[model samples]
Target: MTTSEIWQPPSEFAEQCRELYGLTCPPRWGTPRRPEYPSLGPKAWKVMERLGFPPMPWQRYVLDVALEIDPATGLFAYREVGLSVSRQQGKTQQILGVQVHRAMAWARQNIVYAAQTRGMARQRWEDEFLATLDDSSLAGKYRARKSNGHEAIIWRKTRSKMGITANTEKAGHGPPLDLGVIDEAFAHEDDRLEQAFSPAMLTRPMGQLWWASAGGTDKSAWLNKKRAAGREIVERLWAEGVHPRIAYFEWFAPDDLPRDDPATWRMCLPALGFTVTEATIRAELEKLDPGEFDRAYLNRTRKSTPPQDPNVPVAAWQGLADPVSQAGPELAFAVEVSQDRAWSSIALAAAREDGRVHLELVDRRPGTDWVIPAVVRLRELWDPVAVAVAASGSPSASLIDGLIAAGVTAPEDKERPRRGDLVVMRSGDLVEACGQMADAINQGTAVHRDQAELTAAVSGARTRPSGDAWTLDRRRSLADVGPFYAVTLARWALVSRAEAGRDDYDPLDSVY
Candidate 1:
């Protein structure tokens, strides 16, 4: 009847037990009290107890939020945890609680917590997580292990550490992370996404990820893409097939809430602890326009919001595309180079399923370190994907020349199409592409990451008066569209390349 006896018990006895009881309960418990776990359990629990596996107050809520216990392992069994509560739900505090427990309670356990903003590194530790460390009592168990401007953390006696970081490549880079908890994950980059979670999933320890956010759209963000991919994995795993270490949980509404119901708004928030009370919710409620509230609160987005340029009135041209689908050559990417901006863009312009180009992709770069690198990226990364990009400017022209010098095929030059050439208009290309892109999105044809900069840029880009008319500018541009700069230059460069029959040129002439 005991575990030792059960194993030594005859095969006939085991078969009889299985046939008699649906459960695995035997004479091991109730009959006797054994101090140690039955032989079947692994040695990890001893390490877990030493490292800090059992969670505390706020973290208990998170564990309960994702409460699927793995019976076989006696551990919380979830591949991913996604929290979409409104702001100030002690968001970072909840993460800190669990992170500390995971590190202190488990050995070789790695935890990385990141947020979208620059100052979040300290805010999470000093303002949210490490506040517990300073309380004197918790400090006895854990000590503030380290701090740079980028991060600070406490080391548990068990040898596990929590690394706090802001949302940037430098912070998210190369580490053997076991648990990755990202705040405002919608702000992460699409390409650099590997830095965020790849290390965790690929490791033998196999880290789980937690993606938490308030609300945003895929106007232009890497996190937008990540969250989208996360959603797809969660929503369509059965159809998409199984992923080994990926699980997703998003708790939110289908879209914007109804103005008629105050209770419904209260229910959308996860901070049921009265911190985000009815009074605060109402105050926030009073400040929101119906549209903004709908987008921000309900996790919905409006694709065709007007760009900054008032002259570029909401073009009737673009339509919304699918969120989880793809179309061919509907968008062309244009990249731009600058010595000023810290980043470059690869604009994914719009095209349609109906054989018309609608959207554009632009990848931009700032001066210095990004110049040659951006050009190299354009050459290798784009090619077959983008229809074309502007290959003008000193940097771009030389980049193209160097490629030709190294033996590359340049897109054949087309004569500069003037404004009168409405049939083949460049601005028309943008407008038409954007229109189709919008249509594609509305119709469910494209995929984008939900993010602040991209959403703000797209929604904020508008026409402003220049001379007698208006044009898209920064407070009104969709983004500092480096891709547009690249594509636009490429358009002109091809033409100039044909006329000059030379390998080098730089024409900064969007206007004569």
Candidate 2:
């Protein structure tokens, strides 16, 4: 066909443009919009507009498909709808419009909106939903109940109510829900919310369930399962020409696409031209890790695999254990905190006369309150060459000010940290520390005291990308990695001081 002829039809013209320039990626799998099907989407859009929230093009498209009515039954065609899109795409606003429409159009309807936690749900309901409603023309139409546990928005005439709840097994249990929404479904690890809410909608003929989120990691088992099922259903429909009562829409960049290209972003992010700008995405790309940026912005799920070799080999780590390992006169001490701040660890490193590093776990305890006092006591006794902390982008960063307040002196000049000055390590420094520690263990240049805490930390250590190198990923580690980090920092500080020709220590200067 001629180019001019192809451009004659609107759909054909759009398809040609898309094929040539890679403009947009439609839902990867879902029910296609049928013009013949009547929908309440327009009314929902009108409601949103009246409340000063206009639907974006993508939102309008989703609403039309998700709210399509069955001609025979005069009810919603889809019983369950799943929407997976990148963050900041206005999913909440679209869902809010739908909720408002359902509440106003139907009599005595029960609508429940849930988030990952009860506090988050309550906050969103109050800050976003109710705040918008109260500020708009719709304020006079409903009465809000702001009680701690009994929060609801009740329509004056219809008596239809919308409530907020946590994504627990008990969510939507008491009410026969007309609509149930689970926001940020990626946080859910299982199908507890589905099991609880799906049954509640069975009796209501017009009931619908909605799940919306950005793409998640392998830990998001429930969302992953739902996405897989949605893909399968779409494939089945394409082959057999059959329709199902489930609707799934996904806007995700294909695995093969170049992530850095703006064209690729346009294909995946529906709000690129409307709400979000390319400049904003570019800034985010530079700031966030590759895996995190993909999940948050490209709507790409992370499929984690078991590492062929652990970050630290268990056998190598175990073999380097020494029951009576002790530090010499020249010493460096380091502190680290668990990812959740539930625990903290202090480690000591010393250069032995035998040309080996002596590593020991000084102290590990629950809570952060004791860290400052413990560090102070250790400093007075050991007179160490350096006091190290992996502070940047870590929970341990919370201790920096407290350490300073307790008379712990940090280096005025980072390039040359004086003896007994705190060596605050950034991301790059931490990466170097991890590499140095790994090499020392593998080369038999380091010996540890074989403490259980140290062993557990080494065994469970995981790595995350930091620029060109990697560092310990406390979030993904199976066990508390504070001890491991602490020792790594300690060794790094000792090595750094020696390499810089600044390890001038005296045993007589020790306070103890």
Candidate 3:
């Protein structure tokens, strides 16, 4: 039978199967099987049964299509197989069965399993794969080598060995592979594993590579690319009536589907009734964040967009800007550095005569070399009440020693900061600084000169949880947030210095 004829059960029986097992057989999208072509799927299933881990209906469906033998060439139909499914769907067991079958069926075959890291691959091999094989009926047929960095399971009779390694570009250096499996492929950020394995399997006639994972975030570049390619191939198959060299299977709910509905779960989760239940999924739904639940259980990829600060909306922030705003006599300055350390910003804040706070981005330039001299000049000209730098957990913290050596004095006691002291803002201090800046904008108590860098930073700022509060997440934000963060620290330092009542210097004497 051709691909289309291989998996079409009667409509009534298909509906019954859906109701009974919640198995989305044939997957939501995939290369359909050609039953006329011989396959190793049934034999692999038999091996699984002997190992006391029989294939589920969904697993059988995948194996039947992916393991088909090309009658024209007498080798595997596909050179590669890509399987994307929801978590907790017996993927590991299916993979284990395939690896064991390949080892036992073919003498001297080199099979390899890889995870994101060497340590993770070793852990899975020792804890899951080896443990299961040792408890199986064919336990005595294999010898496991447990030595670190050289772990393998060798079938005694066939002399075929299955090894474990990390998903790195150098992973495939040693020998040619008959079978290579990249498990939990979502964690890989790039195509290094594919680059490593593809050439290693080039000369082996029966060699196959497998990529398996649940959905991942937009940052999962390699997996997302594979998923996009698989989807395109499936669409092509529908239009052209021709099969491709890669076998692709995906089981995922549509973006519009209601996540909490059981019908939606049944559509994507092939092992819903077999190994998982609606009640268990409901519990998971309640426990996991909505985005995480969608990615992990519904197999929906997480979409990402340019960062926007929810705390300070763009319209509200724009309303607080004054193009010609001038700083008041009593001033404070703060420095900030970009997460990549490619750029730095300096900002100042002061108390206005009208009881409002004035904020301004003083200077933002490339590299750290210019920051120390610039800060020293600003201190000499303005005689600001205080200068602040985050004490830890920020790229700007690296400038503290340089600032202190440039005659910017650090407070002997942070709890009792004096005027002219370099205030080392701690985690809690940064959190408070962010909150205070937001409040100043919202309460109409702050004004800025509407600098382009400051506006852009405000537009793209994002935050991460810091204890019970939140601080700027410079690393993850879409744009450079150094300018905005510097302004916030300056405002915070001004208010904190005023509270400490330590400004003994007269502002009228300053050059600026």
Clashing pairs in 3: none
The alpha-carbon deviation from the true structure for residue 357 of candidate 2, after best TM-score superposition, in angstroms, is 40
Better of 1 and 2 by lDDT: 2
Highest lDDT model number: 3
Q: Rate the local accuracy (lDDT) of all candidates.
A: 0.44, 0.82, 0.84
- Candidate 2 has an lDDT of 0.82
Runs in model 1 deviating more than 4 A are: 1-76, 146-151, 170-175, 191-193, 237-244, 288-292, 302-304, 307-512
lDDT of 1 by residue, 149-177 (tens): 53546565776767766565555566577
Q: Which has the higher TM-score value, candidate number 2 or candidate number 3? A: 3
Q: Which stretches of model 3 miss by more than 4 angstroms?
A: 1-26, 304-306, 309-512
What is the per-residue lDDT of model 2 for residues 74-154, given as tens digits with 9 covering 90 to 100?
A: 999999999999998888888788889999998999999988898999999999999989888898999999999899999
TM-score leader: 3
How many clashes in candidate 1? 89
Locate the minimum summed-lDDT window of 10 residues in model 1: 25-34
